[model samples]
Target: MSKKVAVLVAGSWGTALASVLAANQLDVIMWTRGEDQATEINNKHTNQRFLPDAELSPRIQATTDMAKAVEGASAVLIVAPSSAMRSVAHQLKAHYKPEMLIIHATKGFETESLNRMSTVISEELECEEGRVVVLSGPSHAEEVVKRCPTTVVVASLDKASAEAAQGLFMNAYFRVYTNRDMIGVELAGAFKNIIALGAGMSDGLNFGDNAKAALLTRGLAEITRIGVEMGANPLTFSGLAGIGDLVVTATSQHSRNWRAGSLLGKGQKLDDVLNSMGMVVEGIRTTQAAHFISQKYGVQMPIADQLYHVLFQERQPRDAVEALMGRDPKTEMEVMTLETWEQWHS
Candidate 1:
């Protein structure tokens, strides 16, 4: 008998994951917030709004009924955007079975609460920390659905949950690695989008690959610095979720974050850029949330801070870049190896 898995949400990432599970011969049901999408999937095996070119598998079913989606499924994967995670989790809370494993594929911290996606899932579902897991990396929905080579990480405070998620998603083209650093994984996944925006901005300015590469390297440094201060293992930022994801997001034409940043660099207003994209660019909200958290936590998040200024305060992109370049010089490993502020070492 095939294992039953329910994937909530019907966006590109959600549909792609469902397709992967169905390809693995799992009994998968894709739950959508809209009846139209569910009907389209059930009748035509296509989600026209997203993934129009790709056909869904016969084994995969689509439905708008939340109860039917959750009931009797061995595991549930939440792929909604971070903005909707809390609501979706709350709606599923009453129906979540104790034995049913839950994992989140969404990345980004909540703007209002600044809570990571896993934290939102655990808190809303009243589940033990062990029951929740997070899967994130450089796996874009378009590439994953096409069976392109992709690697990602599954992380949880509980080892079993991480392993279970890895077992559920690993296949020939889609490889999953297990990690215990949930905070680091989540933060790395969420915060990298912000840097991707910076990278995109560099591209929009017609900066050479050298400039983009510099932004990426320094962006990883900033992400690692903040993640380490937040009790995350610094090594996690050096792995798939950190530099790996950054490379994909910062360089790919498929990245919505990069596209949005490109527009911003071209002098488009935030609202204008968002309206033009027609899809959720997770980086915009994430930039604000990261900025808030860095201020609250006193982490040195210069990239996120400048991105926030550009998005909200009407700061010019070139000026932001200038400000970043003009900052005080510091060693590359200062955040990682330095002991005290007063330690004088060049």
Candidate 2:
């Protein structure tokens, strides 16, 4: 008998991951709110709205019943939007089993609670946060559905949970790495979206490659500062969840946050920009959360702070750029104390 895996939601990312699980000979059942979507995936093996051109495997199924989706499944993958995570996790709590592995691929925080996805899931499911594995990196759902080569990281404080997630998701076309820095992995995944928005704004303003390169480089630096201050390993910022994810999201046309930022950069109103895109722009919400977080943590997040102004305070994007450029000059190596990074150079 094949192992059963339950995937929450039928969004593009969730559907793409379901395909990978099915390809691995696992029984995949996707739960979606729309009964029509469930029927289409169950009968036609297609999710035209999300993965327009991809065909799902027959081994993959869809259901509207959350309980049925979770029933007897060995692992449950939550790919809901960050805004929906808390409520979805609450619903899952009814069917959550102690032995079932919980993995979340959602990036972004709960703006209200300022909680990580795993933290929300653990609270809802009444499990330890360490048991929830986070899967993130440069992987895009569009490329993954086409069976293109993709790599991602699965991280957890629990070594067994991370390894189990790695084994479950790794494949010939999909490479998975295990990391112990769950805090770094999660924070890096969330914070990089802010920089991607910055990169997109740079492009939309017709700024050339030089400008974008600087923005991305400096953007990475600012996020690293804040992530480290938030208890993440500074080295994680240089790894897949940091630079890797930042590069892809900031550069790819497939990134919603990038597209959203481009619209804002072109002088579109925030509401208009958001209405133009049908998907959730995680970076916008993330910028808001990071704004408060940076203040609370006493970290200097120049890029995220400027983004907060542009996104919520109606400040012009170009003006935000100017503010960033006009900031007080400081040593480039101020990201950490000498003792923290001395080991690397020595």
Judging by TM-score against the true structure, name the best candidate. 2
Compute the lDDT for candidate 2. 0.91
Candidate 1: pairs in clash: none
lDDT tens per residue, model 2, 144-205: 99999998999999999999989898999999999999998999999999999998898889
- lDDT (0 to 1) per candidate: 0.88, 0.91
lDDT by residue (255-336, candidate 1, tens digit) is 9999999988888888999998888899989999988888887888888898999999999999998999999998876665
- How high a TM-score does candidate 1 get? 0.96
Runs of candidate 2 with Cα error greater than 4 angstroms are 338-346
Give per-candidate clash totals.
Answer: 0, 0
Give TM per candidate. 0.96, 0.97
